[model samples]
Target: MARHVLLVEDEANIVEAIRFILLRDGWSVSTHSNGATALDTIRSVKPDVIVLDVMLPNKSGFDILQDLRADPAIGNTPVLMLTARGQKKDRDTAMAFGANHFMTKPFSNSDVIDVITRLCDDPT
Candidate 1:
């Protein structure tokens, strides 16, 4: 089965880079840049995985994650939180909010692919 990914990021360069890598790796990709409507997009897209950014225009990724976890329908879908700042607080916050994995900016393409692959493969 083809895996689908929803990328919620605002940076054009980062979005392009990540989209290129993920598409090259054969995953069908959907991109969304607004945080305020990201949750709605997630519900509509129903992707296998989500790559969410920390900061957004109207809403924050942390708030999105928290809201996502609260929704029963899409709550369990794996989330990979990304941020330019690699602070321990961000990682901890991501995990505490139910992120499956957290990655800092400038992540290697292989690492992104590997993490997504692992997230989808694990049965838990």
Candidate 2:
């Protein structure tokens, strides 16, 4: 089966671009503009990986990451957090909250694809 990804991003244009990239790479992608809805979808879909944004409506990516880690079923799931806040503090905060990886906005599409592909292929 194709790897499935839950993409939580608020920017419509960014979402579209990332979705297109992931789809072209042969991954099934589901998107949510709000973190609350993303949480619900994550529970239902149990995607192979999550591409989350830090600035989301309803809940922050860190908050969602905390919640996911608290749940045993989703705790170990790979998550690649995307944020415009490219600061050491922000990156450290995401790591503390259990994000498996982090990427800043204005990132290269190829890099994002490579990271997600590696994460999906990891057995752990």
Judged by whole-model lDDT over C-alpha atoms, candidate 1 comes out at 0.92
lDDT of 2 at 108: 95
Query: What TM-score, to 2 decimals, does candidate 2 have?
Result: 0.95
Kindly report which residue stretches of model 2 are placed more than 4 angstroms away from their true locations once superposed: none
Tens-place lDDT per residue, model 2, 1-124, is 8999889999999999999999999999998888877777888889999999999999999999999989898778899999998999999999888888999989999999999998888824
TM-score of each: 0.96, 0.95
Leading candidate by lDDT: 1
lDDT of 1 by residue, 19-86 (tens): 99999989999999999999999999999999999999899999999999999999999999899899
The 10-residue segment with the lowest total lDDT in model 1:
115-124
Clashing pairs in 1: none
What global local distance difference test value does model 2 have? 0.90
